[model samples]
Target: MKLYYTPKSHFARKNRILIDALSLEVELVDAGNVADSTPEIFANNPLMKVPTLVDGHQVIYESDHIAAYLVRKFDPTDSYQVLTNDVNQLNLRAVMNGVMTAEVELIMAERSGINTQHLKRFDKLRATVTQGMNWLENQADLFPQQPSYAGFHLICLWDHLLLYQMFQLKHPHLQQHIEKLSGFDCVVKSTPL
Candidate 1:
C-alpha cells in the first residue's frame, strides 16, 4: 500500500490520524511539491490531489474518503470508536471540512504575503469561513453525543487549526466547541499526526 502525502497538509494529517489510530502500515510518498511538477499525482488522481491511497489495485482519493476507507479496511469497529453514526454526521463533517479549508487558505495567505492577487482570494475565503463557523456554532449539538466520521474529522480539523494558529480561536464559541469534544478525548489524544 502507498499513501501520497505532503507533510504540512491538514488533509494529509487527517489520513495520518486514521492510519495511526488503526495501526495501519503503508509507504508514504511525498507528492505535492508542485515546484517539481508531480505529474504522477495528477495522473493517479486526475485532479492532482494528495492523501491519495493506493491499496493494491484500488486507488482511493480525497482525504475524507481515504480516512473512511482506512477505517473500514483496517478497523471495522472504528466507526463508533472515533465518530458517531448519527444522521447529522455529514453536516458536522461539512463544518469541519469548511474549517480545514478556511484555515489552509488563511495560513497560506499569511505566509505568502502577496498583494492584490492573493489578498483578494483571502478576502473571499475569509468571508466564506465566517459563514461556515456560524453554521457550526448553530449546530453545536453535533458533537458530545456519540462518535462518527464527522466527529473524527472535526477533531482532526480542530487540532490542525490549533497547531497552525488559523485564527484567535479563543472566542467564546471556540471554547464551547472544545468543551463539546471532551467525550472523545481518548481517540483524539491517542491519534497523533
Candidate 2:
C-alpha cells in the first residue's frame, strides 16, 4: 500500500500517525500540491487531494475515512471503538472537523488576499473556532482514556491551528487536554516538519 501525501499537511499527518501506531508498512509518496491540479494526484483522486491511499486497486481519500479503514483493517485491539461507540467523542470529532475546515478556508482566503468582502465571514469563522474550543474545554472529561481516532483528530486540530498561527484559543483546560494528547507516541512522531 502507498499513500500520496505532503509531509506538512495535518490531514495527511493523521493518516501517517495511524499507520505508525498500527505498525503498518506503507510507502509515503511525497506528492506535493503545487498546482491547481497535479495530473498524478488527479489520476488517483479526482479531488486532487493529499492523503490519498492506494491499496491495490482500491483508492481511498479523506482523512477520517482513511482512519476508519485503518482501524477496521489493521487494528487488532479495536481501539477505534472508543471513537465509534461514544456519542460525545463523535460529536467532539465533528466539531474538530468543522473548525479544521473553517481554519483551512480562512488560511486560503488570507493567503490569496481575498479578505475585503469576506471580512465578516472570516470573523465568524474565527468565532466558530473559539466556540468549538470552548465546547471541547467543557467536555474534556468525556474524552477517551486512550489515544483513539477522536483523540488523534483533536491533536491534529490543535497542532494545525498552532502551526499556521491562524487563531489562538485561550482555554486552559483544552490546553491541558492538548498537552496530554501530545504526549502520545503517535502524536509525537507525527508532528509536521
Candidate 3:
C-alpha cells in the first residue's frame, strides 16, 4: 500500500497517528500541496487530494474513509473499533469534520487570492469553528478518556489551529484534552512533519 500525503496536512496526520497505533507499515509518499496535483496522484485520485491510499488495486481518498479502510484491511485484531465504534464520539467527530472543512475552504479561498478579507462566508466559517470548539468544550465528559477516533480528530483540529494560529480557542476543557492527547506516543511520533 502507498499513501500520498503532505507532511503538514492535519487530515493526513490523523491517519498517520492511527497507522502508527495499529503498527501498520505502508509506503508514505510526500505529495506536495494537494491542490497542485501531480500526474501520478491525479491519476489515482481525480480529486487530487492527499491522504489518498492505493491498496492492491483499490483507491481510497478522504482521511476518515481511508482510516476505516486501513483498520479493516491491516488491523486483524479489529483495534480500529477503539476509534470508530462510539456513537456519541462519532457525533463530535462529525462536527470536527465540518469545522475542518469550513476552515480549509476559507484557507483555500485566501490562498487563491480571493477577496476573503471581509467576506461573510469567511467570517461564517470562522464562527463555525468557534461553535464547534464550544460544543466540544461542553461535551468534555462525553469524550473518551483514551485516544479514540474522535480524539484523534479533535487533536488534529486543535493542532492545525495551533500550527496556523487560525483561531483563538478558549475552551478550557478542550484545551486540556488536547494537551493530554498531545502526549500520546502515536501523536508524538507523528509530530515534526
> In terms of TM-score, which candidate is strongest?
3
Shift in Å, residue 154, candidate 2: 1.1
| TM-score, structure 3 vs. true | 0.90
Off by over 4 Å in 3: 37-39, 80-85
| Global lDDT of model 1 | 0.65
Better of 1 and 2 by lDDT: 2
RMSD of each: 4.0, 2.1, 1.9
Per-candidate clashes, comma-separated = 4, 0, 1
Candidate 3 has an lDDT of 0.79
lDDT accuracy of residue 22 in candidate 1: 62
How would you encode candidate 2's per-residue C-alpha lDDT over 33-146 as one tens digit per residue?
534576586335877777788889888888888888777788757764533756787788788888887887787777777863447888888888888888888987777667
User: Which of the two, 2 or 3, has more lDDT?
Assistant: 3
- Pick the winner on TM-score between candidates 1 and 3: 3
lDDT of each: 0.65, 0.77, 0.79
State the lDDT of candidate 3 residue by residue for 112-132, as single tens digits.
Answer: 889776678888888888898
Instruction: Point out where model 1 deviates above 4 Å.
Output: 32-36, 41-43, 81-87, 109-113, 116-121, 144-148, 171-193
Per-residue alpha-carbon lDDT of candidate 1 for residues 38-89, written as tens digits (9 for 90 to 100): 5586336766767788889999888878877777777767754443455676
Candidate 3: Cα lDDT at 158: 83
Pairs that collide in candidate 2 are none
